[model samples]
Target chain A: MIELTDVHKAFGSKRVLRGVNLTIPTGTSMVIIGGSGTGKSVTLKCILGLVTPDRGKITLDGQDVTKGDRDAFLARFGMLFQGAALFDSLSVWQNVAFRLQRGAARRPKAEAREIAIEKLRRVGLTPEVADLFPAELSGGMQKRVGLARAIAADPEIIFFDEPTTGLDPIMAGVINELIREIVTEMGATAMTITHDMTSVRAIADNVAMLHDGQIKWTGPVAEMDDSSDPYLDQFIHGRAEGPIAAVR
Target chain B: MSGATLALAPVAAIGRLAIFAVRGVSHVFRPPYYPREFGQALMQIGWYSLPVVALTALFTGGALALQIYAGGSRFNASSVVPSIVAIGMVRELGPVLGGLMVAARVASSIAAEIGTMKVTEQIDALVTLSTNPMKYLVAPRLLAAVIVVPALVAVGDSIGIWGGYLVGVYHLDFNAVDYLKNTVNYLESWDVVSGLIKGAVFGFIVALAGCYHGMQSGRGAQGVGRATKSAVQAAAVAILATDFLLTALFFTS
Candidate 1:
């Protein structure tokens, strides 16, 4: 389980997260939905220790996330970035096998390549795509390669940042389905941040609505439709006029 | 925009650069070195920079010889051309020109590439992947530059003297044998060694400028462009300044 308690963060007096508190249960997929620039990514990065909160307590499995061994802490989590963030200099398999090729979990080159190929297959990429660079692949294909790299080390936790942001509807659906299936099969704690309604419905078991740098509503995805909160309703239905202003 | 603010800005920038350079150089001695990254940096900063450095040295050496011969004729000292060309090339021109050419090429390239990687979150990805960017990225390049630039300077010095030889023997009607003897006998080993030392320092400056500014770059394309521009400018200025200081230390101090 991951717990964030009274997390507050401000960047140069622009308070992005104002006392955000949330809990994600073990072995579940939690989707954080918010409008653009509403601190959804900041919340995720805070948990990952990519961005430090001004005041907060974040714990992973009863241990503080910020205090332990960094490499050991990071070794347990895998992340797929919004832009895929694949290393352009490396081939697809090399990118996927990056973690396996270094540090305490280092493996032989052949073994790492074999595992990378297997993960690529799991993500619907052919073995022939392994040698190609990220620049050679389409956006969707690059996202799949990113997905393959994320799960390459078989981490205990996985983060998907705007996983389906730039894909077409069909391709987005495919990625959402893959994320949902992979999270289920791996039984990893998953935290995904996205405003995509389709992705939320497809990949989330629970949903947290972030508004004004705070969680306005939190419940199971099944309860999201009838949550009875005006903010949640306005956001889910994509209404322009509501208590929540469209323009910041 | 105030006078005080303007005055303090450069001081703050210098402080930041000093901190960055010290931190980067400190990483060079730490454990968990990446040999592969070192090898790649060696190839990129040294091998790829050869052509530009060589061409610059050759032309400067030829020009110096021609100018020296012209000036020496009025003083009835035309025979001083070979000795002056050799000494000037070895003690100053070879390393300074080679360092500047490399600063223009390698520093800009490093900054742009690393700045793009930072903008795209690749550096963050490296962190999440259990790799330190300083160790995996900057240290190897720094070490490679320090090790390889002297070798490049040595090669540049020899080629520069050879350029002078070509101009002297062919264009100036001087005997090839006497020109070679004058260049060889009049040039002390300290002159060559000092320039190579200067090369190593210049290399350190070039890599430092690239890695530091690149990591400190802001977001987007304009940010990357500024970082690249700052890297080359910083490197060239630093190389010239350090050259003067090193020259004083080597010859006067």
Candidate 2:
């Protein structure tokens, strides 16, 4: 389980996260949805230690993550970056096997390549795709490659950042289903952040809405539809006029 | 900016750079060294830079010989060409000019490439994959630059001597045997060794400046552009500063 207790983060004089609290239980999928520029990425980055929170306690599996052994703590978690941030120089298989061939999981190149191919297969990618560069793949295929890479080390926890963004509806559905299957099959705790409701419905066991630098609402996915929170309704239904003002 | 603020920029930048250098050095001894990444950086920083350094050295040596002969002609000391040209190339021009050229080419390239990756979040992806960004991205480049730049300076020195030999024998009507003997007799081990040492320091400066600016880059297109410009400018400035300090230390006695 991952827990954030009243997190606060500021950049210069501008505060981005303000006393935000969130919890994701073991073997469950939680999707945090919000409009653009609501500090969604900042929240995820704080958990990953990309950005240090000004004040908060982040605990992973009951251990204090902020003051814990970083390498060991990171070993148990996997993340899919927002842009499917694949290395252009490395081939797809190499990118997927990156974690499998590092630290405690260190293995021979051939073995790592095999594991990469297997994960790619699980994510609905062919063996030929493994030899291709990231620039050669379409946006959807890149997301699949990112997903394969995320699960390559069989991590106990996974964080997906905008997994379904910039994909067609059909491809988004495919990715969402793949994420759901991988989380369930591996019995891994998963946290995904996106504004896509279809992705929320397909992959989320619980839904949390991040707004005004804090989680405004959270409930079971089944209860997501009937929520009385205006923020939740306006965000889910994609209304322009709402309590959440457009940043632009 | 005020003159006081402008003057403080170098001091502040040096302080930050020192901190970054210390952090990177600490990371090197830590776990998860990526041999593959380092090998690639070696090829790019070291091997690929050779031809350009050689070309620069060749032309510089030739030019130095002609200028030396012309100036010596006024005093009927034209025979001074071979020895003076050889010493100048090895002691000053070879390493310093080669470093500046590489600072222009390699530093800008590295900063632009890495800054783009940073903006695109590829470095973050490496972290998420449980790979250290310092190990995967910076270490190899740093190691390769330090090791390769010295060898490049050595090769450039040899080519530069040959360029001077051609200019002396053909243009100045100097005997080949006498010119070669003068160059051989005037050359000192300390001179060559000092030049190579300077090369290594300059290479480190180039790679370090590139990696530091790249990692510190902000969002969007302008951030990347600034990183590239700063990397080249910093590398060039460091090379010249290090060259002056090394020269004073090496030749003061």
Candidate 3:
């Protein structure tokens, strides 16, 4: 489980996160939905320790992660970045096995490559695609490779940032299904940030809506459509009016 | 403007710069030394930069020979050409000029490459993988450049001295053996040592400036361009400053 209490973050005069509190229980997929720049990414970064909160208590599995051992803490989680952020210089397999080869696990090169190929197969990419660089692969393929890499070291937790952005609907669905299967198969606790309703429906076990630097609504995915909150209704229905302004 | 406001600007900028430098230095000693990356930086900084550094050194050596001949002729003693050229190339010209040339090449490449990685979010990806971007990306390049640049300076010294020898033996109508003998006689251990030391320091400056400016880069193409330019400028300035300081410390006449 991951917990954040009274997390606050500001960049200069702009308060991005305002005393946000949330809890993510073990073995659950919580998808946080929000408009861009509403501190969704900041929240994720704070948990990853990429960004520091002004005053907050963050704990992982009941251990205070606020000032916890960073490497030891990070070793437990894997991440799939928003842009798929693959290294241009590395071949697809090398990128996937980056952690295995250079990871704290300290596996040898040949072993790392074999595991990378295995994970790529898990993500529906063939061994031949492994030799090609990120620039040579299509967007969908790149995401699969990114996903393969995230699970390479078999981390206990995984964070997915916009897993379906910029993909065609069919491609998005395929990725969503793959994410769902992988989460369950690995039994890893997953947190994904996305605004895609289809992705949220396909992958989320629990849904959280971020608004005005706080979580406005959260519930089981099944109850999301029937929520009584006006903000949730306005957001999901894609309506512009009725207590939810397009801009604030 | 108020003195307080004016002072605050430099202070803030310095603070940011210091943070950047400290992070870069810490990365230099840490683990996950990327071998391929270190090899690539070596080729870029030391090998690929040879043509430009060689040309600069050659021209400077030939020019120095001409100047020495002119000065010696005034004293009715033009035999000092080879000896003067050898000393000048090894002690000052080889390391400093070669360093500046590499500053133009290595610093800009590192800055642009790392800056693009920053804009593209690859650095963040490294972080999520439990890898420190500073240690993974910056350390190997810095280490490789520092090791290889002294070898580069040694090569530059040989080439520069040859350039001077060509000028003195052919253009200045001096005997070839006399020129060679004078050059061989004038060469000293301290002169060669000084040049190698300068090379190591200059290499560090190049890598440091490159990584620093790259991390400080903002978003988009304009940010990359600015980072590249800053990398080169900072490297050149650091090289010249260190050259003067090292020269003073090593060989004060």
Candidate 4:
């Protein structure tokens, strides 16, 4: 379980996150939906310890995330960045096997490569693609490769940031299905931030709508369509006018 | 801007760079060292840079010989060409020019590569993978630059002196034996040692500036471009400034 309480963050004069309080129960898929630049990424980064909050308490499994062994804390979580964030210098398999190649999780090179190939296979990529670089792959393939890397370590928690942002609808559906299947199979607590309605429908067990740096509405996916909150309705229905302004 | 804020901006920048340098250098002695990354950096910073460094030193040395011969002739002392060329090449020109040339080549490359990584969020990905970017990226490059740059200076110094020998013996109708003898007799061990030390310091500055700017790069192509430009400019100025300070420390009375 991950919990954030009263998280407040500001950059210079811009307040990005103000009093954000949220929780994800164990073994649940919670997808956060929001317009661009509404602090969705910031919230994810804060949980990952990439960005520190000005005032907040974030805990993972009841342990404060800010005050602990960073490596040990990070090893339990896997993240797929918005851009896929693959290392351009490394080959696909090397990127997948990165965690196994060094630090406390170090494994033999041959074994790591074998596991990388297996994970790549799991993500619909062939073993041959393991030797290729990230640049050689198509956009959708790169996203799959990123997915493979995220699940490579079989982490207890996984984060997906804008997972289907740039893909075609068909590819987006495939990725959404893959994400849904993976979360179900691994039983890992998943926190995904995306605005794709299709992705939300396919992958989210619960939906949280963020507007103006706060969660405006949150409910189970079954109840999301009938929530009746004007902000949530405007956002989900893609309306340009409502309590939430179209432009900041 | 307020007067106090303007005054403190440079101090703040210096302080930030100092902290970054300390963090980067501290990672050098820690565990989980990447030998392959260090080896690749060595080849990139040292081996690949040889041709450019050699060519620059050769021309500078030949040009110095001609200029020294011309100036010395006014005093009826043209015989001083080989000795002056040798001392100048070993004590100053070889390292300074070699450092600057490398600052132009390797520093810019490092900044661009790492800055692109930053824009792409690859550094954050490394953090998520339980790897420290300072250890995986900065330390290996820093170690390679500090270690291999002095060797390049040694090679450049030898090539530079040889260039002067060629110009002195052939171009000016000087006796080859006499020129070599003058060069050998006039150059001291401290001259070469001092230049090598300068090479190490310049290498440190180049890598430090590159990593610092690369890490601080904002986002997008413009940010990466600015980081690369700033890195090269910072490295070149740092090389010259450090060269002056080292020279003052080594040769001043």
Candidate 5:
């Protein structure tokens, strides 16, 4: 389980996150949905320790995420970034096997490559893609590669940041299905942030609506449609005239 | 944009650079060192920079010989060309010019590459993979620059002297034997060693400026372009300034 308690983050004079509190139960997928720049990414970064909150507590399995060994803490979590964030200098397999080939989880080169290939296969990429660089792959392929790298180490927790943001609808659906299937098969606790309604419905076990730097509503994905909150309704239906100003 | 903010900006920039350099240097001695990265940096900073450094030194050396001969003739001391060219190349021109050339080449490349990585979130990805960017990126480049740049300076000095010898023997109507002997006799080992030391310091500055500016890059193509520009500018200025300081220290007596 992951818990964020009263998290607040301000960059210079801009308050990005204002007292955000949420929880994800074990072995479940929780997707955070919000408008652009409403602190969805900041919330994810705060949990990953990439961005420190001004005053908050982030705990993983009841242990404070900020107080422990960073490497050990990071080893338990895998993340697929919004842009895929693949290393341009590395070949596809090398990128996937990056964690396996270094640090405390070091594996022999051949074994790491084998595992990378297996993970690529799991993500529907072939062995032929292993030697190619990230630049050689299409955007959708790159996303798959990123997903392969994320699950390469079989982490206990996984994060997907705007997983289907730039893909075509068909590609986005494919990625959404992959994320849902992978999270189920791995039985990893998943936290995903996306504005895509299709991705939210496909990948989330529960949905948390983040608006004005706070969670306005939280419940099972099934309850999202009938939830009485205007904020949730306005966001889900993509209405422009409600409480959320489209201009900002 | 405020006057007070503008006034304090340079001080803040210097403070940030100092902190970044210290952190980068500190990572060099830590464990989990990446030998592959170190080897790649060696090739990039040292081997790949050879052609440009060699060509620049050669042209400067030939030009110096001609200028020294012209100036020496005014005092009826035209024969001093070879000795002056050798001493000048070994003591100052070789390292300073070579450092500046490398500052333009390698520093810009480093800054742009690292800046792109930072913007792409590759640096953050490295962190997520349990790898420290300083250790995997900055330290290797720093160590490689320190180790390889002295060799480049030495090679530049030798090539520069050869260029002067060619100009003196062929263009200036000087006897080859005498020119070689004068250069060999007048040049001391300390001159060469001092310039090599300058090369090492310049190398450190180049890599430090590159990595520091790159990590501090803001976002997008404009940010990377600015970082590259800052890196080359900072490195060239630092190399020249450090050259002056090192020269004063070495030859003041």
Candidate 6:
């Protein structure tokens, strides 16, 4: 389980996250939905220790994440970034098996490549694609490659940031289904941030709506449509005018 | 901005760069060295830069010989061309010009590549993969620059003196044997050593400036362009400034 309490963060005079408190139970898929620039990424980065909160307590499995061995802490989590974030200099398989190539998780090169190929296959890519660079792949293929890399380590936790942002609707659905299946099969605690309603319906077990740097509404997916919160309703229905202003 | 803020800005920037340099240098001695990356950097910074350094030194040396011959002729001392050319090439021009050439080529390339990586969030991805950017990216380049640059300067110095020899012996109708003898007799071991030391320092400046601006680059294409520009400018300035200081330290009475 991952828990964040009273997390507050600011950049210069602009306040981003203010008193954000949330918890994800073990083996659950929690999708955070929000408009652009609402601190969703910042919140996720804070948990990953990529960004430090001004004042907060983040505990992973009852251990304070900020005060432990970083490598050991990071070993338990995998993240798929918004832009895929694949290293252009490295081949696809090398990117997937990056973790296994160094440090405490170091493995033999051949074994790492084998595992990379397997993960690539799991994400609907062929073994032939492993030798290609990220730039050679199409946008959809790159997302699949990113997904393959995220699950390559079989991490206990996985983060998906805007997973289906730029994909066509069909490709988005395919990615959403893949994400849902991976989360269910691996039983890994998943935290995804996306505004795609289809993705939310397909992948989210629970939905949390973030507005104005705070969680405005959070409930199980089954109850999300029934929630009467005006902000949540306006956001989910894609209305321009609401209590939550369209422009910041 | 106020005058005080303007004055303090450079101080603050220097402080930040100092801190970044210390961090990068500290990682150089730490474990988990990436030999493959270091080898790649060596090739990029040293081997690939040879042609430019060689060409620049050749022209500078040839031009220096002609100018010195012209000036010395006014005093009926045209025989001093080979000796003056050799000393000038070994003592100053070799390291300074070689360093500036590298600053123009290698520094800008480093900044652009790393800045693009940062913009794409690959640096953050490296962190997530349990790799330190300082170790994997910055240290190898720093090591390569510091090690390979002096060798480049030595090559530049030799090529420069050879350029002068060509100009003096063939173009100016001087005896080849006499010109070579003058060059060999006038050049001192300290002159070469001092230039090599300056080469090492200039190399460090180039790599550090590139890596620093890259890591600090903001998002987008414009940010990368700015970073690349700033890195080359900073490196060129730093090399020239350090050259002056090193020259003062080495040659002043």
- What lDDT does the true structure give each of the candidates? 0.93, 0.90, 0.89, 0.93, 0.94, 0.94
Over the stretch A20-88, how does candidate 5's per-residue lDDT look in tens digits? 999999999999998998999999999988899999899998999999799999999999998999999
Tens digits of lDDT, candidate 3, B1-253: 7999898997997788778667766777766567777787788887898888888888888999999999999988788888889999999999999899888989999999999999988998888787888788788777877888888898889999999988988899989988898899889998999899999989888988898899888899999999999999989988999999999999887
The Cα RMSD of model 4 versus the native structure comes to 0.9
Best DockQ among the predictions, by candidate number: 4
Model 6 agreement with the true structure over B128-203: per-residue lDDT tens digits: 8889999999999999999999999999999999999899888999999999999999889998999999999999
Candidate 6 stretches greater than 4 Å from native: B1-4
Query: Which stretches of model 4 miss by more than 4 angstroms?
Result: none
Q: Which of the predicted structures, 1 or 5, would earn the higher TM-score when compared with the native?
A: 5
For model 3, state the Cα shift of residue B161 in Å. Answer: 0.9
After best superposition, candidate 1 residue B91: deviation in angstroms?
A: 1.4
Go through the candidates in order and give each one's DockQ: 0.82, 0.80, 0.69, 0.93, 0.85, 0.87
Look at candidate 6 and tell me the lDDT of residue A218. Answer: 91
Label model 4 with its docking quality class: high
Clashes of 5: 0
Any runs in candidate 1 off by more than 4 Å, and if so which? B1-7
Per-residue lDDT for B134 in model 6?
A: 97
Q: Could you say which candidate leads in TM-score?
A: 4
Give candidate 1's error at residue B221 in angstroms. 1.0
**Comparing 2 and 6 on TM-score, the stronger one:** 6
Worst 10 residues of 4 chain B by lDDT: B82-91
TM-score of chain B of 6: 0.98
lDDT of 4 by residue, B1-253 (tens): 8999999999999999999999999999988799989999999999999999999989998999999999999999999999899889888999999999999999999999999999999999999999899999999999999998999999999999889989988899899999999999988999989999999998999999999999988789999999999999999998999899989999998
